[model samples]
Target: MGNVLGLESFYRRQLRQLLGIRHPRRISNAALYKRCNARPLRYRITKARWVLFGQVPRGSDRNPAFMQMARYFDSSTEGGW
Candidate 1:
């Protein structure tokens, strides 16, 4: 079989490594996004969840989770740019 791994494969592998999921399985990206967005953050800004993550609504780069995922996703593309 030709290589079946692609972006979603990479994403799943990385997420499993980062989230430490024991079982490798199929998942819906939309579901993951919705669930993350729904979880109550500690705070908010202008009635937005970005504040819960201490971000300034599309103006901040302080989310640790975001930073980590960025590293995992982009590090290979540009040698971390």
Candidate 2:
């Protein structure tokens, strides 16, 4: 979940910074749904993350829940990022 959010944020920020957009781009609900239905795993996990967590909370860089999520996904471990 955390990784998905991070991936989305990274892509969003890159698009905004590179394109000089003042606001985030609008997501196409229909297209997004179709993509998910067509390829659950191959499709972007960020959208799924958004559906599940609807804008994840922010605070410390080392939030415990974030760490635990990473660990569960095998992306990171106790030593932390």
* Cα lDDT listed for each candidate: 0.50, 0.52
Across residues 1-81, which tens digit of lDDT does each residue of candidate 2 receive?
666567656655554455454555554434443544533332556567675553334544387766556566674356544
Model 1, 10-43: lDDT tens digits are 5555655565556655456555535445321222
Badly placed stretches (over 4 Å) of model 2 are 22-42, 45-81
Whole-model lDDT for model 1 versus the true structure?
0.50
Best by lDDT: 2
Best by TM-score: 2
Off by over 4 Å in 1: 1-5, 24-27, 33-81
Cα shift from native, residue 28, model 2 (Å)? 10
The TM-score of candidate 1 is: 0.26
How far residue 72's Cα lies from its native spot in candidate 2, in Å, is 18
